[model samples]
Target: MFKYAKRLQYPINIKKKDINMAKQLITQYGGIYYKKDIKK
Candidate 1:
């Protein structure tokens, strides 16, 4: 699961259409959250 954080350390800017779609696919597969791998 992914939790909405206040902000991400870096931005996720996908400009290219193809690349953007790929990013979406990856997000759907593994998700796009920090995975609580912060401040740990």
Candidate 2:
């Protein structure tokens, strides 16, 4: 049970980092993270 919980938390932590990076990239590129009509 402990191992499973650790595995689940690992992905969530990675996703949070990814989101932070995306936000930084968007800001760096003038607040445009993607082109129009793209899914979020």
Candidates' lDDT values, in order? 0.64, 0.55
User: What is the per-residue lDDT of model 1 for residues 1-40, given as tens digits with 9 covering 90 to 100?
Assistant: 9997798888899665785565566667767663443242
Q: Per-residue lDDT for 1-40 in model 2, tens only?
A: 3553334534444433566677567667755645442346
Where model 2 places Cα greater than 4 Å from the true spot, the runs are 1-17, 31-40
What TM-score, computed on C-alpha atoms, does each candidate reach? 0.36, 0.33
By TM-score, who's the top model here?
Answer: 1
Candidate 1 residue-wise lDDT at 36: 42
The candidate that wins on lDDT is 1
Clashes of each: 0, 0
